[model samples]
Target chain A: MNRIDKKEAKHLLKQMMQIRQFEDAIMDLMARNIAEGGSHLYAGEEACAVGAMAAIRPDDYITSTHRGHGHAIAKGGSLPELMAEILGKETGVCKGKGGSLHLADVSKGNLGANGIVGGSIGIAAGAGLSIQLRGTDQIVLCFFGDGATNTGLFHESLNMAGKWKLPVVFICENNLYGMSVSVERACAIKDLTKKAVPYNMPAECCNGMDVLAVKDMVTKYAAKARTGEGPALIVCDTYRYYGHSRSDPRVYRTKEEEKSWRDRDCIITFGRKMQEQNILTEKEVTDLEKEVTAELEAAIDFAIKSPDPKPEELYKDVYFESPSS
Target chain B: MREITYRQALNEALSEEMERDQRVFLMGEDIAVYGGAYGVTLNLMQKFGEERVRDTAISEAAIIGAGLGAAITGMRPVVEIMYIDFMGICLEQIGNQVAKIRYMFGGKTTVPLVIRTEGGAGRTLGAHHSQSLESWFLHVPGLKVVMPATPADAKGLLKSAIREDNPILFIEHKMLYNVKGPVPEGEYLLPIGKAEVKRPGKDATVIAYSRMLYFALEAAKRLAEEGIEVEVIDPRTLLPLDMETISESVRKTHRAIIVEEGTKTGGTGAEIGMQIIENCFDYLDAPVLRIAGADVPMPKSAVLEKLAIPDAERIYREIKTLVS
Candidate 1:
């Protein structure tokens, strides 16, 4: 095991805590009818996004899933833009056109999160192809749930990526459910990593609750892929604390089962480990929490106050026509 | 000037564009090895190799999804659907993703993609394969829909669509593929969204597109023997339609007849009829006439199929009523 320094560990812990607090606040806002529309919470999967994002450069691209707040935040997307997009404000990242499921920050190399299951896998492969064609050393990280692995698009994208030697890392966040259906029921083969073998790509499974473990494994794989060693698939055994969406009561899983994963909450595990190692003092952790709370509140306020898109602007930007024309 | 079939003209356009720009490539079902179902992409795989001229699986959504991704990332992709009816499997990707990407992204992206599909019901292919669905795309604002009726326009307009910085749905009539005409040999581009007057006359304006343009012209030739001079106009591109030219023709001719192979109810002709009434209603001598396919689905029987879609005889009948 490669040990990270105390400061690095503290910084990573702070980011994870920030993601947790932000998601919790979004849930609260949704309940209060402040954030309209359906929202998929990322409460229990912060470590997967934060750890994998920590391993990549800002210029390296990433395609995300609908449960994507953590991925967006870790990839350096502005909180104001994300919040505004959810609120359907004109100042949002996609200018109110793309809501929660379609958040994008191209400047930070974070491709948009897709509404369709397994939609972004092919997109990520194409992004990898773009990088290869441009002779750039950038790699694309594609994040999808275990449910998406069963999609034909997944196999198609994986096969193409393998054949083309595209530089991409396919990350599967196996929360063990595809919406209401269990992974066991949906997939014949439980282990998604094994599916990568037929494509001639390296595959690995990691402890999704352990941020450092995920970070270390991803760093190695990402470095290899960036150097043109081809694509890699990493299956992170994670869990979602809440149900699939805002409406799901989560009756599929037993209370004991939910509690078991909750006990290994990524944010709690990382914070406790950092405290035990004396990396972050209690006051520093509290200050970080307070800072994130204030930031989330400010973002919510900005989004609520922003005006809606003008009706006349609907026809604009449909194409990249010349301005003079 | 050079003489070539519409199919060869389209093939030459694809070949020339691919050679000129490395980012331009072609992908479709059986487009590579089989040279396209209509033979519009023949011998391209041999010239550009498999990497550029790709043959994808039978997944329509995946084929178009790959095209969307490639287009946004700086590649100009020309994707061919075996038939327009297959767009049902990939409409969300084309209508929602490819069409709205640039606008939804605040102009931060560009989908320079062209989806080439053949429509029209002369092949006796039945309801599943044959249908003219241009109105479905024209109803969407983000897409630019073009239908070239002649060999020369097929080559020039396709080249323009390839060079365009937006998503264009280039609809070709299956019946027009074998038709031969004079095409310029060198690099030439026809302006999109512009209508052309094929035969100028004074009595009535016959507006049409795709295979319907041939019928309209034939009807006009037949009407000329009866002392009815008809102006035949083809609104080559439907979405950004040249309303000015069409309205001007209507103003000169006084009478108007909109002809299309698609169903008359809610068809592209209906939209054109509405535009004429809105813009040039006062200049009209009579209510604009619409000659189109029957409201029912295209039939498999040869005689019934003939009755379903508009032809020269039907167009001539409609023109006679309007002129009388």
Candidate 2:
């Protein structure tokens, strides 16, 4: 893997901060009853999505999970469209039909945020197979939580990808609990990566709070997959800052445990590192924060001003242009 | 012109489509070396090789999901789910994903995938193996469901389904696989969503599809012997149903008898009956009659299974009742 430079490190830190702030604002909106529907906040797990995306090219594809705002942001989905989508506005991605659970930008190769657990695993494998058949060097990054590992589709897709040497990197953000059930209680194998070994694929575990560590591991595995070395699994052991969704108060874990993980927050840890290296001053970081906050505020305003989709428009787009229409 | 089995006609359609379009491929369990559960894809592996005529794992969800992914990314995938009953495993991917992708994506994406599966009872495969779930798919808004009753239709309709831009659920009756009929040698296409009047008459119309169409034809022959002329109609495509052809026949005949092999309650026959009543009620001389399978799970016993499903005798009795 190549060494990360000062400029690249700063950019990574900014992305992590952006995700943290965005999720915080979403939690606040949900609390105030302003944002309709629910949201799966990706606060503590930002490092995994940011680092993995940073390792891949813009053309590489990714299949996201229901907890997907971070992945969408990291994959370059516009913040305004994402905000509008959460608000169920017509101008949003998927024309607001998908809402928070299903956000897709196929043009950028973000397959879609899946609502079904482990549903996108096979889809990602198929995309990788397509890339292999087309003779393109593009790799597909399949993202899922610990809960998805138990699904039959996950094992089936992994086995096929292993046998066919499909270009894909399976990134498991093991956030300890799959909704309310802990991975230890649900899984027979405590080490999540060990599950990959049965399929004859190499596996590794990384401290997901450290973006640089995740970036380094993903870069190596993604390169191997691109060169037809077969699929690899990277288990990023992390924690979610908030409950599973807006409804969960997170009675599953101790408050002390949550605070301990929060102490090693990815955003603060990376920001402190930048300061120590003299790469960024406190004033510059504050300025970046201000800019990001204003940008998100404007995005909310855009979503509010966007007109609702017309009722007659509902019948349109049901089929690929009906024979007569 | 040539004569071929319905299974062979379907195989030729698949082989021709694969040869004509590089993006077209076939995937199913044992479909590669073993040819297929019913031998419809026999010798295709030798022609297209493993990469194109691929055999899949027993994961129905993965099979359909792979087809959905491949179709969206510029490929025409024909997936086989050996039995229609097995569709329950992949219903989410098929119903929620493949069927809704085009509409949900606002028509930006096209899923040109065909889910080929066999339905109906005859070989005593029983309960799970012998069920007609075409009505379940027909109820869905975005899916196009097709069932061919003859060799010519098996070839032409399958070709049309392969050329379609939406997800098509192509159903085949397990009993009709070996039935022989005339099929043109050259390339031919059948317009989907159109009904063909197999045997025209002016007394009463018998609407049927798949294996039931054969029963309807047999009933028509018996009715003709008694001098009570009957019109036999096959609405080959269930979703984009050919109401125009069916209503025209009902108008001329002044009565209708819908035949189906599925359970009578809420079956495809019910849908056809409702459509005829809604569209051609004023033209009908008698109330629409439906001759369908008994409202019970198909039995494993050969005698009980035969008694459960609709046959030629049942069709004849229903048509006689409607006309008398």
Please report the candidate that would top DockQ against the real structure. Answer: 2
Worst 10-residue stretch by lDDT in candidate 1 chain B? B101-110
Superposed model 2: Cα runs more than 4 Å off: A322-325
TM-score of chain A of each: 0.96, 0.96
Q: What local lDDT does model 2 show for residue A292? A: 83
Predicted model with the maximum lDDT:
2
Say which docking band candidate 1 falls in.
Answer: acceptable
User: Clash pairs of candidate 2?
Assistant: none
Assess each prediction's global lDDT (C-alpha) against the native.
0.87, 0.87
Tens-place lDDT digits, model 2, residues A1-325: 4355667876787788778887888888788876889989899998999999999999999999989899988999888888888877888877777778888888788888888888888888888877877788999999999999999889988887888888999999999998999998999989999999878899999999999889999999999999999899999999999999989978889999999999999888877777777778887777777888887888888877887777876887667654310
Please give, for residues B1-324, the per-residue lDDT of candidate 2 as tens digits.
679999999999999988888888888889999999999999999999999888887889888887887777667889999999999988888877888766655556777889999999988887899999888887677889999999999999999889988789999999999999999875889988899999989999888899999988998999999998999999999988999999999988889888899998998888999999999989988888988889898889999999998889888887887788
| TM-score against native, each model | 0.92, 0.96
Task: Score residue B200 of candidate 1 by CA lDDT.
Answer: 94
Cα-based lDDT at residue A79, candidate 2: 85
| Alpha carbon deviation, residue A286, candidate 2 (Å) | 2.2
Regions of candidate 1 where Cα sits further than 4 Å from its true position = A185-189, A194-202, A323-325, B295-299
